[model samples]
Target chain A: MTGNTAPSQADARRTVISVDAMGGDAGPAVVVAGIAKSASKNPDIGFLLHGPAEELEPLVARRKTLKGRVEIRDARDVVTMEDKPSQVMRNGKGTSMWSALESVRSGEADGVVSCGNTGALMALSMLRLRKLPGVNRPAIAILWPSRNPQGFNVMLDVGADVRADAEDLLQYALMGTSYIRNSMDLPCPRVGLLNVGTEEHKGRAELKEAYALISQNAEKANFEFVGFVEGSDIPGDIADVIVTDGFTGNVAIKTGEGTASLLRSAIREAFEYSILSRLAALLAYTSLSRLAKRIDPRRVNGGVFLGLNGTVVKSHGGADATGVSAAVKLAFLLAEQGFAEKLAARVASAVELAQDDATSADADAPGDSETGSTN
Target chain B: MTGNTAPSQADARRTVISVDAMGGDAGPAVVVAGIAKSASKNPDIGFLLHGPAEELEPLVARRKTLKGRVEIRDARDVVTMEDKPSQVMRNGKGTSMWSALESVRSGEADGVVSCGNTGALMALSMLRLRKLPGVNRPAIAILWPSRNPQGFNVMLDVGADVRADAEDLLQYALMGTSYIRNSMDLPCPRVGLLNVGTEEHKGRAELKEAYALISQNAEKANFEFVGFVEGSDIPGDIADVIVTDGFTGNVAIKTGEGTASLLRSAIREAFEYSILSRLAALLAYTSLSRLAKRIDPRRVNGGVFLGLNGTVVKSHGGADATGVSAAVKLAFLLAEQGFAEKLAARVASAVELAQDDATSADADAPGDSETGSTN
Candidate 1:
């Protein structure tokens, strides 16, 4: 395991991230160019690029920045977006995505990064790396640009699975809190359960049950529980970690993205409507660029797979060079901090203790009302 | 009942809508001013203003346009935002919201419009107006400004209930299609079931079952079934009618609104960052305003409660005069066209047929696995 061979502080300064250099909407050229940008700026980072060597070699050779830091791994197949997850899982032995994950599994790379199909990537990761002990479900956590002091908030379970029971939601909170604490360096993150309304009586029965579980564990887990938060609070300052089932989180994120896209196109069309508006766009270019950078989804393009034995970052499918580079940077940060091992340890300890508590109560009641079972 | 009192085409030309002049965050002044604006523009519309006579009489007197078009109904109570739904339902006899709904109940007005507590309004609506026969649950339908040829798409069940079984979702699709057909004049609206992913196998068990139900009913119901759609399609052109349970719909809309607000504030701060940017803002004001008006939430302020015996439009709780006027205008249009009666009949006939199918199937197979129950 990488945990045993992680090396001394001096050797740990350098980290390797496996890259799936195929299957993204923007093509391998963008992925190669993106890694080159990250490798040039961060000398401590190296890549294990997986794809057809013929296609990737030319792209790598064209970029002076990628000179000795990139290692291309030849793979025979590519996973398309239309490929079913079950099909990919069964026939993906020689695929680039399979090779990329294999590097992480063998400890040849500290983490894996892919801009391929999200479902296929997640299915492969779960199959190869396996879920952490005591974890019923793994979640996908993303950073949303927010008005918080950290400039971003972590939202979790964004389409890993469509459902989360009370126990699954509590586990999501634990994993999310550990993630923000390790990556963002917050000592005690404030976690909020996502619901239809902020009122205590609102939302589904499972949410209300999840709220009680999360609240009970917040103090012991070293995070503050803010009870239930509405969808609007996802981008607000009330909570640093927003926890919900995959269904709500997935729909909310996509809806937010769609709205942002709508506004961007509208603003662009407005600036192109007249000559005076064109001049105004020119003058406001710098400020506009700065504003765009702050809210750009590309800047925070990575969605980390939590509760897995290994770390994996999934970039946007249509991400360009800049977006891919952002995902690479995120993988580097998580790898440097040993996020995967730390998260597993955190979840294992917390969940084990929770199970012990449930067991003791179960011994007394003998399966009366506790229903102590993993979802 | 409005179904019995609905007038002839000539009499319907002069429609009367009851306006709840209290309970909104903006106070009765905004409501009175809003009705005045609508009454001045449409000579065929009249208002039944529900509030304190002293408070509304002077506001109505100042507007010569409302001289003969408005009638004041004195109400001694006001329902505050802090009031619970159950509390309001039991003790809200003399409240403006109660008075407004009562007018519709007694066939004194063709419809009702209120910028009040959504939960209270819905509770009062269901209590006083009742649900249409054979309708399992009522849904709140809203107009989402979109890229459709009609320039808007209808989304339903925005917060009427947090839970929906497969049958409820199918009912939402049926009701939404009928709404778009009658209001937007779309002969055969394309209905899409909202899911975590567009793939058939994605999302929860209920969504999968709902997909099959909606698909089976499409041909018979006279609407195009677009299989499944993701949250991004809410603002996209693939579906003219987006149907989901109230929880997902509510969260998606609020998340969209919150994101738009974030971008709005960010753009404002960008323009105010420097004098040069302020000059650019000045030059871009005309173009910016045009874009703003196009996507303004106020332009689509009302949420109509479908599957009800009478039509009721719920405006934003904090809406100003412009927003309230928009709601009033929507109420006027629906009342003029007897939308409430038409929608009730459509739902009753369609649902009766669906229930018959369920009963015959149940009789044949007993409990084989239909789960034909409302949520």
Candidate 2:
């Protein structure tokens, strides 16, 4: 019903992100270390580390390096990997995950960054924050593993919706496009509907129709709908925002991640084979790191929930200290820019334009009184 | 209408596959060489070469190597990358692209394999060969780049459907599962729908619903639905057959291919960095190749157009001799196993199970339908 309340610069002293202190394999210590490091570098940025006070209290940095830049927001429960979404929502009440999001909702903090259960986060966000206007659904878009200079393309609904029609796609395109433009700061980003082929008739019947609507309406006049893009096309600097159902989106992103890992392992295996290969590995270490950095998803660890009323950054649950640091930093940017409201406004305008056309069509067919259908 | 045609092994003659004799960077000479090698290895195999009579004419191997195994099917046209799919289809009367697929559809040959224009092949095949029974759409399933002994995952709708919905997803699962069983000889392999997350409510609404339906039906039944698989899951032997809409599938495959190339280039750059690294490269070359072999999609180039009336393999348009050769070899295996007809029967059975439910839903007070509606 409402957009994220823009924090007044004068009223707010610092940008604070609620981080799940217990998240990641290395646990709260790594998270606190990352926060302390990030806070030390950016004096204006602060953090509310959420988790068991016992572990995090001792782990919290007490140095002038991060002086006046951090605080611990204690929570009793820890939402582990095996926890259900509903349990995270209902039972994990004063838990780090819930408190973090609530902090944002109550305007205690600028945003919430989590590396905990994704399903729990989505469920909680929907319940606490709620989707924005005209957003029948919210999509969690992350940077797809790619070769684009803009880093990686942002793909949404990675695993959000399973059964969606044309409307959801149109919304995702507009929302993703807006987020990239306002948050990621791209110019006239190309938006492509992920499909099997470039052909108009390819994909499911719904996709064919979605393609026609995207093409015909000239939706998001600011963004270019670069027609349909295939799986292979994703690596190219073709589309800034590639839209698809969450099923495909999730698979595509993971595929890239998997390949990167596979390549890394292969290179490692090659290096371990013999003394010569071992020598090459040592000699080529710098070059390999360079390549890894260029393709690293961790550098940009946070994925903003586009089309939502406020900012929520979903960091990798398997993230290290480096990833957690990046996620906190990204949240600062989104909140500072008031990106959510900007995206919501842009998305609202597009939906309105689309709705106008639909209303006129209904007006034209007043006599039939037929149900508005996709057939 | 028919179960697997029973591998025609009962008959004396082997199923023939007409390959693009003039296709690929290596040209007909390579095709001639590869065919000779295959025929010599498998005495039952036969080759139908399509190209200009002159180009297909003279060869040293023609007499000594492929003397009786190879047969030239004369055609005047060679479809280059520059040629449009429409142009290739229009000139099918004499072009290598058309003749390749037509030769199989006409029953002049058992099936067709082409390394030429993918768009041309897909267009011509759809135009010439009908989809198998109960197949609402035909999709291509490609192996995602992966390493390790289990091989990689099979992604459906690689270049088939651009957009997809619930029904399309169900069909892809059926066809992909059938492909694994009949062709690859994996009985009831794990089937996974690619998405952002594995939760019942993750990904797009369409995908979530699809996940629900699949997990309910495919979980403990004919196929194992492994809940949800992420993009990274494809390379780690999580599931044998991975299903997703075409958009994500295509992007995932391409991203894997491009990232692999990028990594490969980076590895080369690492080698050229210094004398020591060069030595390492030399020492590590064998191990690297072994790893590359595990991740090479080219080795698995042949992707069957599942749910098609006849067996057809669409090789990558940019494939070289080795890639095309792989596709040809795969097509041969499918033909030998009568994969297409058997897959069709499995798909038909699944559809039959859903028919009564589908009929009731459609026949009841119809909801607004978008069978062909666009956004």
Q: Top lDDT: which candidate number? A: 1
What is the lDDT for A50 in model 1? 90
Error of 2 at A71 (Å): 2.2
| Residue ranges of candidate 1 with Cα displaced over 4 Å | A1-13, A355-375, B1-13, B352-375
TM-score of chain B of 1: 0.91
Best by TM-score: 1
Candidate 1 per-residue lDDT, tens place, A1-375, comes to: 111122223245569899999999989999988898898789898888899888888888898877767778889799999899999999998899999999999988899999999999999999999999988989999998777999889999999988899999999988998899877868889999998878887789999999988887776677899999888888888999999989999999998888888888877888888898888788779778877877787889999999898989999999999899999999999988888888877877676667657767542344323222111
Docking class of 1: medium
**DockQ for every prediction shown:** 0.58, 0.37
Tens-place lDDT digits, model 2, residues B93-187: 67876777777887766778776666667777888887766777788877655442445567798766567788788888877877776655566
Residues A84-113, candidate 2: write the lDDT tens digits: 887777787877888788878887787888
Docking class of 2: acceptable
Per-residue error for A237 in candidate 2, Å, reads: 1.6
lDDT of each: 0.85, 0.70
Tens-digit lDDT track of model 1 for B99-135:
9999999988888999888888999999999988877
